[model samples]
Target: MPEYTTGKPWRLSAFPPLLWAVALLLTLSLAYAAQSGATYILIDDNLDTELAPPYALLQEGKALDYRSTTRVDRLMNGLPRNALRPGLQPLVGLMALFPPLEAYLLHELLVRLAGLLGMYLLLRRYGLPGPRLAALCAGLALAWAVLPAYTAYGVSVLGQPWVALALLNLRRGPGRWSDWLVLVVFAFWSSLVLAGMFVLAAAGLLLLRDTWRHRRIAWRPVLGLLVLGISYGVVEYPLVYSLLVKRQFVPHRLEFDYARLAPGGVGVGLASAGRYLLLGQYHAGLFLRAAPLLAAGLALAYAPAGAARRRLLRKLLAGVGVLVGVALFCGFYPQLIGVVQQTVPPLRAFNLSRFHFLTPLLWFGVLAFSLRHLPGPGLRAALVGLQLLLGLGMNTEWTLNVRRLLGRLPATEPTYAAYVAPELFRRIRQDVEARTGQQPARYRVACLGFAPAVASLNGFYTLDAYQNNYPLAYKHQFRELIAGELARSPELRTYFDAWGNRCYLFSAELGKNFRVAALPERAVAHWAFDARSFRRLGGRYVLSAARLLHPEASNLRLLGEYAAPGAYWHIWLYEVR
Candidate 1:
């Protein structure tokens, strides 16, 4: 990789004034579209559940809870009855160490802003010619304008782009101390997968002899990074706790079973690799369509100035190596794949071609590096055309796949203004106050008839979708049914409480007639309880009476149905008591 930078220093002109105008337009367009539900539409639902809890949590101002405390207690005894714990994430606690809500919001913002910044960084890093950079930037804007995940992660915000920007500036100069601080912050808070990739890339650079020689070896920066990383790790006590104690490896059905490790694993590896490659057969087939461009770029490299040739080769090799490593690891290591699958639970829930993202980044980098050698305008135009054609022929399925991914998301019915009519949650809260005489306290609320979107709206604790398996249930009945089996067994609860959860947020219809001897003696006025319907869904009962309360009157009224457009399951929210 160090060898690749030996070319004539590519000088980038400031973006043309006209290009700035275009960039502005693209930004505004993307921002608007994102606000219009495009962002939610863009995520790869299967492998991208990272957005769900955060999105729900941010909207609700609360953390996850269980509908059935008995079920949860059976699952994890150490878990607090009603304290905010990090969601099913183990790698993210570092970021959340500072202030989970702030870090999470920052992460969301960074992903949103990365769209523009990624283009700018890519342009500045390679020193693309003004016109070319302008074109590329404009293209990126437009591409992302329609791209949903761009907004979903808040890419238009500051997250991914900030990292790229930090790297670019770091390469330009060590940068201000503030810059280092920000990078350290992002490293902890950003997607752990992306952070892991960055760590590997940095490791790769540190390994390169040329890099070690050309770059001053300083213990200070390294120490700074270490200190920062450690600080983050410490702060993310929840993550550290989980990693050190809670997380365990399990053989998910879809992923490879590494327990059968053998010396003949290469054949097994290749077969597994090919299966994933062929899984998204359409896009994978089209990815092959970039071969000609890769070839042509190589052809140009041969005649190129020796320095450029060597430089391009280094980048190519590193990119290829990393990509291959990612593929192989994902294919062969059941543990690695299982861990990633846990982060994006839906990937296991829905069988998707999780590797599709790699192809685009791989080809784009290769193609971008190759652009330096083109003879002139005609050649560059041809190269650009090839790229466009490749993109067009490429995965048109990203959008649809994103929707599919969103659909499979366990319906985390986080309360959002969008979930019900705007301000409806507030209105309901006011109504509760009017009827009940006491203002709601900082406590978890139960949605008697539906999933609680209350967390999203009232900024109070609420239940998780996994707690409502029966409401969202179709085929993945195993996790829930197994829990149900354990629910009735006191012996099982003793062992289950090790995981730190105890509540289950079930649709009232699912746990019908399940007796809860601990219903609060005092109920808030105006909240209704229909024993029949309550039993139909798992009956809504609080596990910890001191921490939970029910309404005296059954004025359970419709707040709003949770929004689940193109979603796989019905998600509704109701306000009771």
Candidate 2:
């Protein structure tokens, strides 16, 4: 057994298991309440396109045809076959067992519970003891449960707890061969982009610190970790290369506006950091309110003399160092951003604000560690109680805010709900089936002005898609097709952003010639409603909200119109002859 150095064993009695149970129950209750009377499948942002097809396939017990039906396939012309992380496939498979909504809820609940458990284990590994440890665990579990950062529709939330678990194990060092194996597996299974980056950052920092302290680099463990990371990469090389190299999907980029960078960018970044660290979101007043208490705690904790003060300062600095480093990269250095982008394209998506997620964990860890060193037991207990109160308050606020937002969601029939009305999709499918007398795979649907993602939800083989990982060849082909007189030198029509991301604009002449208006955002060379192009792409139906000049084109027949309450525009369905 490890020797207890900080306190008497009596004071460090085993924390009651009931405390953990209560914390978990509270967290689950909050999570369930937040989603009450609402669909578990969140349809925000890219989630509409990303998960809908997978969910549909899972329901049908059909293998994921990543190349044929998904948005990636639609946009990229089936190149790079699979774009999703392999880690997420297992969860999707598991969720397929139950009804879609129930499956989603169950998955979400399990992930949240796992996160709480991981955090509890992490705190225990940090040598925290007794009621204080129990309180901290409960508080953190509750806080994390309600935190907005974890509620997003991406894999980041799923990856977070695993990342924490990996960090905990990494900090303790591998005890055996089995431990090493688990670490490697967990690291790889965590979200490739978010958790992978966290592991790299944390491991690098810890290594640097250890080397600096010992005055020599530890080669064996480092090499072992490197081997594990490399092995994981080797296994996932296809997916990695597809996204990083072929797709050039730059999710995050440095906000290097000269006006924003100079004079006030640092201050703004700092303020943003503080907001994220405290409230996990942007609210000027919340930061202002919490700043004094945080400042007082740090000042009081570090005021004492001796080695303890130095240690506390070092812990505080470690957390601050990460935040500061990210801020510098994000706002202070444009040239450095360019260099990093060129060398490490995968890390381009490492935005400064994301470090906010890590900051609270570090700060809480430091605060928990420093509590034992306070002047007296009473003061220590008081500080811990205060932290628990603060955590509860923050969690309550977050829960209420989320509930309020969720309450605003349109209360429609279960089938025709969320981002795209299911009723509309069903009608479209029926129409197509009636027209063809069978649901054929070759028949493609195209959405011109409406979001293309709706096609995926309805199980339509679509000709339009909105995705970051668009195929280079397809993009070039589409650009050339739309180039008209500039077909020989299409670069003249293409525009590249500051980051060299290419986007093609349609000239007024092309719009006049094609008779297309109100093109969807991020359209292929701003192409919309070209009957010839649609026919060539095997498109049988076109859905649009825009006004087309020749609505009664000889080859096109208007099928129906649809409009749902709270929807922005009327949907017009046309069958191409």
Candidate 3:
């Protein structure tokens, strides 16, 4: 909605030096980490969750398989390959071309680089023409590139600039081939459920407004947007097939009780709104909300002194208003939409509250427009410099890398090398084979004190995993094994039942800690597990990250306690005999 102007290309000077330097350093650090595989990569909801599926598909020789029924047996007892993310995606496709970590790193770098260039193009092509303004826009673009976004999510957040540029190009009569190309590739590179649907909705509104203003349908932009939508549908064929054609599998999302889970009272809703407006939603990666907020405040105060006039003030303020309105809407949506979901039932499966996914780009776009209006180069540079520092400070991955380099990484955290200890897992896999006298693929293992991703990533067939979507029935079945433990912990029970996306092995003793290494290595002394159900559900081994006091209490046989130097987890492999 920020692209409401027209302009000719203007030269940005060599550019905002600090941001580019920081961006380069972050890129080099990540590249080095990826290449060396000896430092921390983001773990929470990342390496242990999203990255597992594609890497598992790659590991299982199904990275390129696009069939609807193609199953990857490594996860949740052959979770329908469709249940895992589509391989037709650019990120997963990269896995086929390179090793997992390197591929992930390359994909991340490409997303940022594309964002940098795309934002530059959008700014230069719209308003913001002079050298200093253009340079500031470039700095804003670079700031966008390094905003701690989820790497595996591809271009969902960062690709918004490309989408905006492409649509704006189409609005100017019969656009270039480059515009169409951007949409097509963007369809493949970005997630439909994440930001695509919201983008389409917003674009539709914009198109409607344009038609009303000009007294004719903006058919070209509409047609271009259609191409974008259709491309996404094609790329997300598996999702379409699973939801529409495939009748047997039901997602656990349908069972979600928003009231019980999120508890969206007015107070909570306002808090959530404030967080999104000021700090930003955590998943898409909050960066420099302060930058945009501060820039808008300054621009408003200095509006009369605008060397460029009040049009800049109106444009940026419009953008800020959009952010505030959207944030409040998103914040209250869970509470407000519960009635609709309850009435429709099936509609509950679709997460309609993700409109905040559009905010990061919106925030940066606002920053760019605000920078353009600021009367002087010094003021603009100061704002840009403030943004550079804030973005750098908030980017946990970049700071984590620096800490890893300096040997001061927190004791609680594990490096990418230590987290996924190949040598240690290889030994554990061999030990399991030696003890069980069978390939890991033949028997499913459940992780106790750690993420199942650790085992699954190491090529073990896992009974449990951290996934976005899996069979509802499998979730119920998996719960039986953890039901005893769940009974003891109401919090864990509510967590698994009310919003059971995880469907992981929950423990009352460990209390929802997938990685228990950070805490004192306390034994799960009172684990009420159903080993009979576990083996019945095809579980043969339990790879405990910490020791279990009495294996006999749960009919488990401790095979061995394994440790590798520099590894985060000390696995206690147990057989469910």
Candidate 4:
């Protein structure tokens, strides 16, 4: 019907059975969330860093400020605005148009919807099972949609289905107009460094293989890929310009020592391999707990059916093998990178291990084969159902939201309101201003026992931050405050000196557990700091969630204790004396 598939065209005919199935599943998910409480949002990377910049830009009316001089001064003294993601992205720009909580929820739902639609269409266009097996294809698409991931990444991870469809379809010949449309939209929304660079590399290889095999260049597909690559270049103009034109600062990624950062033995490597192969990567969440069962089922079905099952079974096994290989490679990545870093000095920063991100998409495609040939329809249906349940159950955000809605949320899990209590921070700002006779703009503060992100969100200029990328010179400068602590513990030393993403105030007593709860007994007993160095950086105060045992020893004096009812953090404000 669509040139590639000599089967029925997948259109939503009248009642649309596939659409109903997807809708029912999505409704069940939403109903469960509604019952649980909907105020909660994923905090970890989403609220802390990713959401912060976009929300701040929206507040400041600088969402479109692409000026080189424009900086998100709230982060790392003054992190370049370009250092954050492009705010013009439709999903990201949602923050500018609505309240943060609403924006986050909307973003999450929209991406999932896009993912579902994209995956289902991709499956239909490609020769997957058949358009007739509505439930199986719809189920597969639904599973891919509700993955445990951050919406801050937009559709980059979930949008893989659309990306593959566009490329592969184009490679076959001149694909539909929708395929080209999909890629243009994808390029604008996707992250070049995270997924696009890898996509481009894969496309390059695909082109080479095609040329070698066909003995002729496939110009249409080549042009399609080039358009996608160029679109990425256009959208990520700031990032591209920084790389090519003017790099005022060195990226902290350059100093990454993977050997020290990720250390493990062969057993650990094998265990990691198992997780990656079966369970999937954490960021690109796919709980393929049912994958083993699927494999067993496929093998059993193939054992009885001779020649008919051979092609499908072999392809499935090969995909499994490739995924296992990827997992093993990921496990031993540090060792491999260590060798490469020494040989190719400049390429040290590039994280090639991200190829593992492709596993979920490949694995799902393998499942498409299994669905068609999996003997019994009842058994096939059960497999899809189990996969759905695993994905939903394991999803942290949904689970937490449900718990919060039911009022069974643990003290550890703060709701979105509790996490970013702007009123609490507003009070802190007022108290500090009244006490010091200086605005937050005049002074920089550091956080102990909690993330510096808390201070950053509250309009406080913070000295320490959880920046993924920043100037390496700043990292060296910040190390002065924690050099003694790093000397005390090798673990902390390796954590900061080698990895160093969270360039925050480190302590041996704290031991990298930044989320320090406010309890009477909880305090940093062995607190130490280079006060003069902190002062030189213009850090005037320490906004800690835990009290310092001997404040004077670290050249700090108690200013005030601040807290709001039902909030996560109880601040023990201190001045650098």
Candidate 5:
């Protein structure tokens, strides 16, 4: 391995002035669009439930109830009702400066820029210079910016670039006491950045190995890393307490099928990784699409280069190996997967496929390095042009998907408006306010068979909030209710995992009282509504998209009906007496 000069400042001097100008222009354009009320794409399950509450509290001029005001938080018994990543709190706090929609767009833009900068730094550290470095950085920035994954992923995707940045910083050992300070600070920051522990762990281990091989045992940096790890634990105390002390954390079952554990399973796992790496689209043509870039990158790696370049290539290859190995292990090994699920409750929620983010970074590095050795200047320029074109094409695909998912909303509309029609919510809020004289918080509303985030978006307190992390007490109560329902009605179909967590299929009887239209086959969970139980839990109103099919129960009185757009289901309101 070739040695790098320690203590070199992370500078942009190597990039051309024009590249900087273009980056600034792109950022400004994004900022302008956000300011103009562009509808953002946020399809992740917790995008609204987990993220919107704190921002809403901030907007209301209240201290961020770290235990968010959502129903999930209310049910939990913990110091910080929400498991907040300490590093990301500052970014979340920054969201208070703008409207929720604008805040989301701005945050996405900044993180994407950070990702681009990190990629540039990593390529620079790998010894790419001048126009080759510039071209590679631009290509990476464009490709990442256009990827469809971020549209559905929201802020969680920020972890990808953060991991890249951490890896880049790790490449250079501390030369000064201040460098040590920088490194330590970065370590702490990383802990709070993302929940994707696998990628972070892989990067940290690779860096440690590289450092050990390059220098005498650096106890100071090692100790700093240890301190950072401890600090992260301290910051995540609420989560730790919930999982270890309170035993409130429950691991979700893995999404993949474990039955195909042999050759077929292995093939499926590899194909799944390929899909994620290739942006989960254009699956049939993925290899064909990536062929040129892959060929050029492999050629560059094989060509003669300096010791430093070769070392960088080796490091990247090792990193990819670690990621791929871990992904396969999680994919094919059911027993191991079960163990991880049972032991690491927090990590169980992560989809193994997301680790594909790591592979692309290494591949992009290879592409960057290859650009320098691609025969003539003309050929290199052509490759760069091709990359840029590919990026544009990817971005176009992302835009179309966004439009399709969000309907007729302009790209400049607030995203919340698209998901929860502003007019419909306004009408509902207006009626509720008039009925209760403007204070909707006095009574909690239950959105039967609708996403709980809808209530949060419209500024109403709700009885239902969707999230994986719920209090043990709530889960217990829910399970008991499902159990009682099953015992009373033998015909009701339900499925329970080995863990005893149950998902009850919506029965005709259950559907008659509650809106169960458009739900999955086994849509009703242990937490599905029981009118008497909900009434005891302080639910005073129920808003549903489907009409109640059963005769009015003694407790539920139909209030009124509201029309919605032809594409949407009608809204029905009921007063839970």
Candidate 6:
């Protein structure tokens, strides 16, 4: 044996068989419990477009707006919208482009298996005692449940942890070409943009390196440095290519709105909003609260001196560099900030603060690594316990004050809430099928809350809801309906007419609430018929095309109500012939 200088002969090697057995038992138990919770969520919430990019990609393929490159169509076109722009980034979409069955298997592998493997690699790289590493990782997964985004999506989304661990390894390496290759792949795979910023910082620091003395410089870190060049290349090359060569998608609309730099404005350029996502609040706030400890860690790692100091210091520097880089880029990058402000909500609709997701992880990781090399177990434990207590206490006080001021809800209930109306949709689909002898399978519907849900599960298109294609919808390309410019275009009017003619019509008041002012008043009135002509179907209500004299529907009928008792509101269905 090399030495038993460490504790308990590295528990993993000591009791491999026993450890595997225990792991199996715990995993099975956890899987069973998760399956139970999985029952309450809808198909969209299950493994679909609201999250997992792979599923989103698959949905994009099913929709076939493949050539529709603009942002509006990108969300609305739905298939793996990211698949439309094939390459290394949007790695989730790239994975999705594989054969469906294989894509699913690979996606499962990446999101779930890779995450576990990533954690294992991290522990191994850090030279943690196997048992201690296992304990730490298990505690993290269970208590903190660090993979909340993955859990929410019902997909692993392992890219974040995978990148974190890989970058951590790259920090202390002059390894084989394969190591560098893996780092490159990891860099390309970060869709969260946090990873991209980290890769950039890592590369930048490498550029500033003059020499690696006691330890010879390796090619892996150098290879990994390529990621920084790649990022600049990605943005600059496209614009240059458009301008010089083909002029593909240009006027080169590189927007620069510095007002976003103002405290509250949502403009894109040089704004706090973008930076806030990566840097998060702590760093973004006055004094760069995390900076000193970050500086201390860097000082220990880089300040010339002792060999013992250097080894540990190097690791700290590399890790801290990655953390700081991620923070700075996320704080600085305007487009990314705007993206979060646009796509995710409560973050968007309410606070317009998109950075909260990555912020917690950044601080937590920094805190963990900063304390990693404390002298002894007892001392380390005390130091960690103190930090945790202090940090948690501070956060609690901050949260309480913020809650008192802003009246925020506790984490359990989502703020800016939308209802779960799965039963309502199922009823609509069923009744439409029964009355018209045609299922709602072939055509799309236009209800607010249930359109994406319907399109995802029922495999139909929805006019009112856009998937990942926010550019078109948000930019108002579908302006004819939203701005009451319905009279302006024959094509837009035709689309409205066809939508109205569908056998399925979800109720209007419900439609109005869901649309959030996108739908033209005329579109709702023309398609939904009138409040006066429809009859109530007991718990459900419907309007018939027969009641309203229109060129489209002359003979329509009321459908039986499809709603959970006590949950009835606006989402009723009507069958028009």
**Clashes per model (N, Cα, C within 3 A):** 63, 0, 1, 2, 2, 17
Query: How would the candidate models be sorted by TM-score, starting from the highest?
Result: 3, 4, 5, 2, 6, 1
lDDT of 4 by residue, 1-577 (tens): 1233557455545445557656865785573344212366666666766766676667566777888888876677777778777766875678777866677777778788888888888877773546567666787788778777565687878888888888888888788898788888988877788788877887688689889998999887788888898888788888888888998568888888887776777887788778877787777775765754564466556556776567656776676777778889987888778778877866656788887767777777766756656666677677777777787787888887678667787777677667666777888889888877888889899888777766766778888887787878889999998888898889999888887888888888878677676544368787768888999888898888887889899999998887777677788888989
- lDDT (10s digit) by residue, model 1, range 98-185: 3332343344344434544554555555535554455654444333222223222222122444444445455566666765765565
- Which has the greatest TM-score? 3
lDDT of 4 at 159: 89
Question: Mind giving the per-residue lDDT tens digits that candidate 3 earns over 324-442?
Answer: 99989888877876777778888767778788888887787777777765777888888877887887778888788788777788977787778887878899888767766889878
TM-score of each: 0.51, 0.68, 0.93, 0.92, 0.70, 0.52
In model 2, which residue pairs have backbone atoms overlapping below 3 Å? none
RMSD in order of candidates: 12.6, 8.4, 5.2, 4.7, 8.2, 11.5
Q: Which pairs clash (backbone N, Cα, C closer than 3 Å) in model 4? A: 36-405, 37-405
Q: Can you write out model 5's per-residue Cα lDDT over 1-577, one digit (the tens) per residue?
A: 1234587555556556337635653753342342223344443333445454454445444433334332222211111344433323434555667655666556556555555554555455553566445555555455544433342233233234444444344434533454344333443333332433544465567667866798755554455455555655665555555555764434333322223222355576676555444443221111113623463555545567788567656754664455456446545444445456556654444445334444545445556656655565566556655654565455533354346454654432234444555567778889888877856656767665455565566776665555443443444444432455555444442222222222221233354232232222222223234667656666677776555654154256778877545212356788766
Q: Candidate 2: lDDT of 478?
A: 46
The sequence of per-residue lDDT tens digits that candidate 2 reaches over residues 1-577 is 2346677564323545435544555554564443423433333333445554455455344434433234334332332334443424444655566644455555556555555565566556553556545665555444444333332233344335444455445545644564456446554444445445555666677778888999987665576557557755754565565555764332312222222222354576566545444454321111212432453365555567887677767766765565556544444443444456566654444443344435445555555555544454555555555654555455433344345456643232121133455665677678767877868355766665445555566566665554434444455544432344244233333221122122222333232122122223122332233566656656677776553455554256677876555343456777775
Whichever of 1 and 4 has more lDDT, that candidate is 4
Q: Candidate 3, 84: how far from true, in Å?
A: 1.3
TM-score of 6: 0.52
lDDT values for all models: 0.38, 0.48, 0.79, 0.76, 0.48, 0.38
